[model samples]
Target: MDLAIVILNWNGKSWLEKFLPNVIEHSDESVIYVIDNASTDDSISFIETNFPNVSIVQNKTNFGFAGGYNEGLKNIQHEFYCLLNSDVEVTENWITPVAILFKHDSNIAAIQPKILDYNKKTHFEFAGAGGGLIDNLGFPYCRGRVFENIEKDNGQYNDETEIFWASGCCFFVRSKDFWTQNGFDARFFAHQEEIDLCWRLKNSNKKIFYTGKSTVYHVGGGTLNKQSPQKTFLNIRNNFSMILKNSPISTLLWLLPFRLVLDAFAGIYFGYQNGISHFWAVIRAHFSFYKQIPETIKLRQKSQISKFYQEKWLVFKNFL
Candidate 1:
């Protein structure tokens, strides 16, 4: 098959029941696989019983998003791999545009479809709006989202464009290119690993694109709630590691510290607005990042290449 749609599942049987039909309906020409991350629930049985034609790859243990997909992808070999989230309801004919993009340009390594909120259909989703973009200091934003601000889908980003990264929510990556970067960082466990992978691809002069021709409705925060402290911790810690693992040492010298300061302000703001647990989650995330610095820097030394950051100071210009 030209494309394989792989959804990573971790006790998300309800999501599968709700959204898998959309994926199967839209991707009749492509193979579909549910890669289970050792769910204690009956997710595997549900898939086997309900969608017998769909393939399954069961992990021995829960590996979170990064390790789970890394392990699951080893079993399938296709020209393109769509790492779709279980909670995403793909629109009709969603996969064709991305496949055409890959076929048209060999250099385009990855692409994301236009993502709108499933609950709030008129607005862009937070995970990936039009496409993923980053600031000079390695902070990520999107064409339709910056911080907590999600833009209304007024066809503002309808044009297909080259992007810095594609959301893991329903991201499409060339299978060979994915293996070239060694897949997602297993150490990331979950969160921000897609950015790191895209950064590596970008460093090697590979293009990532956002195509509005295809669209998907994402029920964001399915596994982890938006306000969950654990989610906050993972996002904060993993983002720091992503910057360190992919950025130049020269940039990291000042940029890392500046990010820390900015993140500190973020922690304070979260504390002011929410509560101490949210603030402490940020503190805990920084500590976790500090502890992993030596190992993450090693990853940086190995993967750091010349190309990075097409845009700069996006946080200040757009959000701040």
Candidate 2:
């Protein structure tokens, strides 16, 4: 099947420069497309000169991760699509193994190869986190990280199975399924969008998976620095947004009180230290859900096409 390898960049001229060559070295069954979110850094001219073979969509304004990837994916007319972070490196022709996984399981909607970070050999890239998982409260953590056990990638994790969510970093998915699911929620301009999408798939009885044989090294948070407050704000906001949009009624009912209490405490504590910016960040998160209700309702209605409720939903949710 033809695949579109969709990569998004925002002022990442250098990352694209180095990454595109290595990516082509590892996989060639797909056409590479870059969605450049208005960068003052000459990313457009650089790509035009250095990577003449690749297709680049130059956006006039920065549209964080979700919007940028959505913009790129919309233009791709391939049998399948690979949403990749420009800063990551694939270890091989990862799509072959992923296609095999898809062939074996019709229920699999998303399949993310095992992701590791190498700049620091011991630390797992928190973005994908050895296959994404979630707690009861719509709180996403990973196998390699919880409150934090984040182990060194010493080749310890090899088992592959159905998972709660696939990492968005370098995920491969059926193009039709992606568009049918309405792609990433534009409301979630950045973080937790994959988990939200996978949760919808699971709610519809589709499986999300992580495969061990395929591997890639992620640079992690290429567009926005992890420590940036904007990142924190988006993460917090999207968590609430996902809870509002995707979780089954029962799952949402169970998670609400627990998440509220914890996040409120976090908001208070962080506010005291970082002053009002940290405080307002999470408060805005809580309110962002309200701001997004019009689209949220439409999303919920669209996602109900093949909803899997009660037992199946619980069984899938219980996997975490």
Candidate 3:
């Protein structure tokens, strides 16, 4: 099958230079695409000078992760689409194993290769370890990771399994499935967008799988550095929106009061400590997303929400 590998980058020149050859060699004959989020650095010019064969999408402003990739997804001319980071390198066998799965089933909407730590080599990298998994609360996590905890890259989680979502850092989705979900929500600006997309696909009975046979070496959080407080804020705020925008009526109402109390306290605390403005902004964003809930509700299919929840045993993250 033809694969369109889309790498979203922002000032990732050095990392791309080192990993592009690996991607090119391993993903032979595949279309290599570099979507730059208008890095202040000369990333676009560098790509033109250094890797003339790769396709380039140069945005004038930094579009963050979702926007950069959404642009790439819209333009890809292939059956399969991969949203890989510029900081990742693939194994020689990477694409082979994952592609073979599509041969067996038409329902599999996406697949993520095992992600390993580039520096450690022997340990797992948490970014998108085995696709992506999350609790019902929109707290996006991974099968090999939970909360801030990340597992080692040992051969321990070497078996294939059904995944909640494919990692945004390095994962693939069927081109049609992606377009059907309208790709990642650009409002996400950065995090938790993958889970939202996957949940929508779940509504269509599409399976997102984790393929262990394929692997990629990743320097996790290379783009936005997920540890920054800005990153923290996005993760928290977006998690709230993801849950509000995607969860079914029963699920949302079930988690409402507690989610409300937590957000209320969180807003107050952040406001008191950070400032009233920051706190009020969070509350406003929350209400804004809540207001739009109806729009998403109308788009959902397979209201038997239990099908998605039952597999997880009715789990939701306690993190808020």
Most accurate candidate by lDDT:
1
TM-score of 3: 0.84
Per-residue CA lDDT of model 1 for 271-311, tens digit only, reads: 88878999999999999999998987667635354323323
Candidate 3 residue-wise lDDT, 229-255, digit = tens: 566467666776667666766677777
lDDT of each: 0.90, 0.79, 0.77
lDDT of 2 at 191: 84
**Per-residue lDDT of 1-320 in model 2, one digit per residue for the tens?**
57788888888888888788988877766788888888888988988998897898877677777777777666678877889988898777677788888888777888888787857655777777678888776779887767546677766666678889888888888877788778888778888888888888887778988887788888876777766667768888788778867766556666866787799889998788777787888888777766876777677744443344545667888996
Error of 3 at 62 (Å): 2.2
Per-residue error at 214 for model 3, in Å?
Answer: 1.1
Collision pairs in model 3: 123-153, 124-152, 124-153, 132-165
- TM-score of structure candidate 1: 0.93
All candidates: TM-score: 0.93, 0.89, 0.84
Clashes of each: 1, 0, 4
